[model samples]
Target: MQDEPRPDELIKAVADFLRDQIAPQISGHAAFKLRVGINALDLVTRQLALSADSDAEELASLKTLLGKDGTLVDLNSDLAERIASGVVDLSTPGVKDHLWRTTLAKLAVDQPNYASYRREMQGSESKEAASS
Candidate 1:
């Protein structure tokens, strides 16, 4: 497989592309357009980190917010990459609606293969799942 593009390069390219090619063509004349432009750049930077590494520790740490099984539910790497590439509209007002909360709940009991440690968790109970 080929090496993935660095997230920083992707972010910079996105910013440059938007600034030089897209921003000029935007119809808005308001100062907020510039603010929106800056926000897009910042958002792109923030998104890039999501694909840098697996967020296992972050998921583990979020057990409280996520509930017992939520941490074990694996993140969709494709979703992470898309988010990093700005292909997913996470900045949209209703973006949270797309979260996989229900899947987490189901995984807490079924421990689907989509779980972070599916092979390890097989034939295990919730207590064993935690250690996995």
Candidate 2:
């Protein structure tokens, strides 16, 4: 595989440039669009940085929670069906934890700065320690 800067770094750099340099030079509708573009780039950077581990952990959680293996999409579909049919619910062991972890992982990539996400994360370390 290739090295240096990497895709995430490259995206972050462009986003930084847009936010710090370009945004200030524009106004009105163009400025609004530029901010949107920067936000999109930032999101791509977060996804590139976080999705690999997030997906792997999510896959593991699904396998253990469902007692089977499949593509993430397929496993998630099965989980959804089971949930809809009342075959699986929060009362199931690991179901709530798996859903919580999955939601946290997604929020980390989608909007890490969100206030509730920050509050949830502040308690995460203690919760992990307690569980351990």
Candidate 3:
């Protein structure tokens, strides 16, 4: 379809250029806006790279929790109904873990460098090691 420097690579290159070159050279509101733009580009690049794996994992988790198969929107609706009706909840087996992992997956795509996300990731790894 397309050529070498793929979409994600192109997006990353633009964001990196803004962050490493333009942003540092600018000042005042322009600098702030430039950084914001760069962050948005970076987030898009991360999403393009990570969304497939995260969506697959999320779908699998939803299937396991709901005990059925459907599109992501359908499964999400089912999960919402179950939560709303008190049929299942965080206390229910697998629900909390599924929710946490899903949240982490989302954070990885939207804000991988976020401090709280990094902390939670380390905590999860430690918990897994302990359980194993």
Please report the candidate that would top lDDT against the real structure: 2
What TM-score number comes out for model 2?
A: 0.93
Model 1 quality (TM-score): 0.31
Clashing pairs in 3: none
Badly placed stretches (over 4 Å) of model 3 are: 125-132
Please list the C-alpha lDDT of all candidates, in the order they appear: 0.52, 0.94, 0.91
> What's the TM for model 3?
0.88
Q: For each candidate, what TM-score against the reference? A: 0.31, 0.93, 0.88
Q: Which is superior by lDDT, 1 or 2?
A: 2
* Model 1 agreement with the true structure over 14-125: per-residue lDDT tens digits: 7777777776766656536865775566555654554223245445433433234443434444445557788766464433443444334334333334547464356446
User: Which residue pairs clash in candidate 2?
Assistant: none
- The true-structure Cα RMSD of candidate 3 reads 2.1
What's the lDDT for residue 18 in model 2? Answer: 87
Error of model 3, residue 22, in angstroms = 1.1
- Best-first order by TM-score: 2, 3, 1
Higher-scoring candidate on lDDT, 1 or 3 = 3
Tens digits of per-residue lDDT, candidate 3, 5-94, equal: 989999999998888888878999999899889889988999999999999999999999889999988998999899999999989999
Give the lDDT of residue 38 in candidate 3: 87
